[model samples]
Target: MKTNGKKTGSGRIAYRKRDRVAYLYLLPWLIGLVMLQFFPFFSSLYYSFTDYKVTGGMNWIGLDNYIRLFTKDADFHNSLKVTVLYTLYTVPLKLTMALAIAMFLNRDIKGINLIRTLYYIPSLFGGSVAIAVLWKLMFLDNGVINAMLTALHLPNIQFWGDHRYALKTICSLEIWQFGSSMVMFLAALKNVPKELYEAADIDGSGKIAKFIHVTLPQISPIIFFTLIMQTIQALQNFTSAFVITNGGPLKSTYVLGMMLYKEGFAYFNMGYASSISWVIFAMIVVVTLLLFRSSSAWVFYEDEEK
Candidate 1:
C-alpha cells in the first residue's frame, strides 16, 4: 500500500510537470500580450490625464480635459451624440443583415464556393482608402444614385448636400460592409447541432420557427460577439465620414473619430485629441459593459453556470 501511494504521488507530479511544460510553450504569447496590449492600454489611461500636445511636452492637467468637455465643449457633446447614434444604427442593422444573408448562403447550393468569394470581396475592400474615395464619388450630388432617381422620374437626390439624409448614406456604406460579420455567423451556424434543428423540423416547425427555436440559441454567442465588435467599429468610424462628407454640410456627420483626427493631426492639438480619444474609449467601455450586463438575460451557453 505504501508503494502504491508513492506511485500515485509520482504520477500526480508528472502531470503537473507536463502542465508546466505546456504553459512554457505559451510564455511568448503571454509576454507579447502584456507588453504590446496591456502596456499600451494603461499608457493610454495616463495619456488621457495629461495635456499632451504634438508640438509641446505633455503637461499635467488634472481634470481639465473632462471639465472642458462637459462644460465648455459643444462639439465634443455633438460628436459623442453622433457616434452613439451611428453605433446603435450600424451595429444592429449590419449584424442582422449579415446573419440573414449568411443563413441563406449556409445551404449547400450550386457554386457556393464562388458565392462565398463574392460575398467576402466587400469586407476586403471595406476599409481601404481607395474604396472610401470611390464611395465619395458614388455619393456625390450628381452621382449614380441620383442618376437612377432621375430616370425613375424622381427628383435628383442629394446624398451629401442634405444634412439630415447625409448621415444615412454613410450608414448605408457601413451596412454594406457586413461581409466579415456574415462569415463569422456562417461558421457558427454550421457548427450548430444538426440534431436540434432536425428535432424542431420533426415537430412540424417552419423555417422561422426552426431558426428561432434552434439556430439562434446555438449561435447566440457569435451574434453577441459580432454585435460588440460592429458597435465598436461604428463608434470609432473615421474613414467613411472623412472620405464621404469630410464631416460636412455643417459638421453634421462629425463623429468622435473625425473630431479626434481634426484636433490632433490637422490642428496639431494632441492634448485635446487625446482627451477626445479618452472620452471615446470611456464611452465604448461603458456601452460594451452595458451589453455584457444585458447579456446575462439573453446570452446563453451549453453550460448554464458558465
Candidate 2:
C-alpha cells in the first residue's frame, strides 16, 4: 500500500519510517535529557567557574573555588578522607557479600523468586529519608544490633554514637542495598555457560576450583562494571550520612556530598558547591577510566574467549 506518494516495505522506505516512529516515541526522553540533564550540566560548568551564591549574583572567579577546596579548606580535607574511606570499605564488602549470596541462590531451589524479592526489599528504600532516619534508630545504643551483641555476651557496641564506628553504621546502610547489584550479578552469572563448568568438572575440578576457573572469569566484566558504578554511587552518597549521623562526632562521617550541601544550602555558596560537584565528576571519571584501563587484564568476554 502507498499513501502520499510514499513507497512500501518492499523498499528501504519502510525501515526508515519505523525508525522515524521510534524516534518520535523517544521524543519525550530527548526533551527531558536536554531540559533536565544537558542544561544542568552546562549550567554547572558555568557555575563552577564563577562566584555564584544561592541568593547572590554570579561573578566569574575562574579556578578560585577549586583552589580554595584543595589549599584553603580544612573541612574539604576531612570530608574527602571520610568519603574515600567509606567508598573503599563499602564497595568491596557489598560486592563480595552480594556475589556470594547470588551464587548461592543461583541453584535449583524452590521459591527462589520469593527469596530474591525478600533480598531486594532493602534496595527499594536504600536512599529514602525514612529508611535513613530509621537506620539512626537501628544503630542506637540499645538497638537491634547492639542487643544482639549483648545476647552474644559481647560488649554492646555503640555504632553511630562514636567516631570509631559511625562510619561502620553508615556502611551497613550502604551495603544493605547490595541486592540490586546482586540481582545484576545473578543474571550475568546465569549467562555463564553450563558447558564450561561441566568441562571443568570432567577435569576433576571441585566446586571452588570450578568457581575460580570458570565462574570468576565469566563474571569479571559484570564485577568490574558494578565496581565502577557502585564507586560512583558511594562517592555521591548523601542521605545516609545526612540522616543518620549529620556528619556527626566531629564531622568524622562528612562525605563530600554533605559538604556540598552545607556550602550551597546552609551557607549559600553555590559556586563552591558546583565546583565540588565538578571535582566529584572528575574524580569519578578518573576512577572509571582507571578501572577500564585495568579491566583488559581481568574482564573476560566470550568474543575474546580463551
Candidate 3:
C-alpha cells in the first residue's frame, strides 16, 4: 500500500508538470489575444463614449457624439442611405451571378479547371488598390472604355464625375468579384446527391422544377451563409468607394467606411469615428441576428429531415 501511494503521488506530479508545459505553450497566444485583439476591441467601445482625440487625451462626453449623428448629421444620413443602396444592389446581384456561373461550371468539360481558375482570378485580386485604380482608369472619360465607345460611335461617359453612374460603377466593381461566392456555390452544387435529381426526373419534373425543388433546397444552407457574408461585406464597403470615386463627385458613393475614415483620420474626430465604428459593429450584429432568425425558414438541413 505504501509503494502504491508513492506511485500515485509521483503520477499526479508528472501530470501537473505536463499541464504546466501545455499552458506555457498557450501563453503567447493568450497574451496576443488579450493585448492585441481584446484590448483594442474593448478600448474602442470605451472610447466611443468619450471625446477621445489622437493627441488631446480622452474627455468624457456621454452621448453627445451619437446625438449629433442622429439629429444633425446630414452626411451621416446620406452615407447611411448610400450604403443601403449599395448593399441592395450588390448582394443579390453578386449572389445570383455567382450561383448562375457556378451552375454553368458544374459540368464535365475540357479546360473546365482553367476556366474556373480564370474566373477565380478576379476574386484573388479584386479588393486590391491596384484593381480599384484599374477600375477608375477604365471608366475615365478618355479611358479604354470610352475609346471602345468611340469605335462604336457612342458618346463618352463621365463615369466618375456623374452622380448617376458613380455609385453604379462602384457596385459593378464589387459584383465583378463574385468568384469566391461562385466557388462556394459550386462546392455546394457538387455535394448535392445525383439521386435527388433522378427522383425529380422520375416525377416528370422539368429542369426549372428540379432546380426550384431539388437544387435550391439542397443548396439553401450555402445560400444562407453566402447571403450573411455578402451582406456584411456590402455594409462595410470601402475600397471601391474610396479608391475609385473618393466618395465621389457629390458624395454619391460615400459609404459608412469612407465616412469613418474621413472622421477618424482626415478630420481627427477620433471619438466620433469610434462611435461610427461601434455603430457599424452594431449594424453587423443586428443584421447577423436577423439573418439567423430568418435562416430557419429557408435554410435546409438534410439531418433535420432525417
User: Each prediction's TM-score against the native?
Assistant: 0.86, 0.90, 0.90
lDDT on C-alpha atoms for all candidate structures: 0.84, 0.90, 0.91
User: Which runs in model 3 stand beyond 4 Å of their true positions?
Assistant: 1-25
**How big is the RMSD of model 1?**
4.5
Query: Which run of 10 residues does model 2 get worst, by summed lDDT?
Result: 2-11
Report the poorest 10 consecutive residues by lDDT, candidate 3. 1-10
Clashing pairs in 2: none
Q: What TM-score does candidate 3 get on C-alpha atoms?
A: 0.90
lDDT of 2 by residue, 214-259 (tens): 9999999899989998999999999989888899878989999999
Question: Evaluated with lDDT, which candidate comes out highest?
Answer: 3
Poorly placed runs, candidate 2 (over 4 Å): 1-10, 13-23
lDDT of 3 at 286: 92
lDDT of 3 at 240: 89
Candidate numbers sorted by lDDT from highest down: 3, 2, 1
| Model 3 C-alpha lDDT per residue in residues 199-273, reported as the tens digit of each score | 998999999999999999999999998998889889999988998889978999999999999999998889999
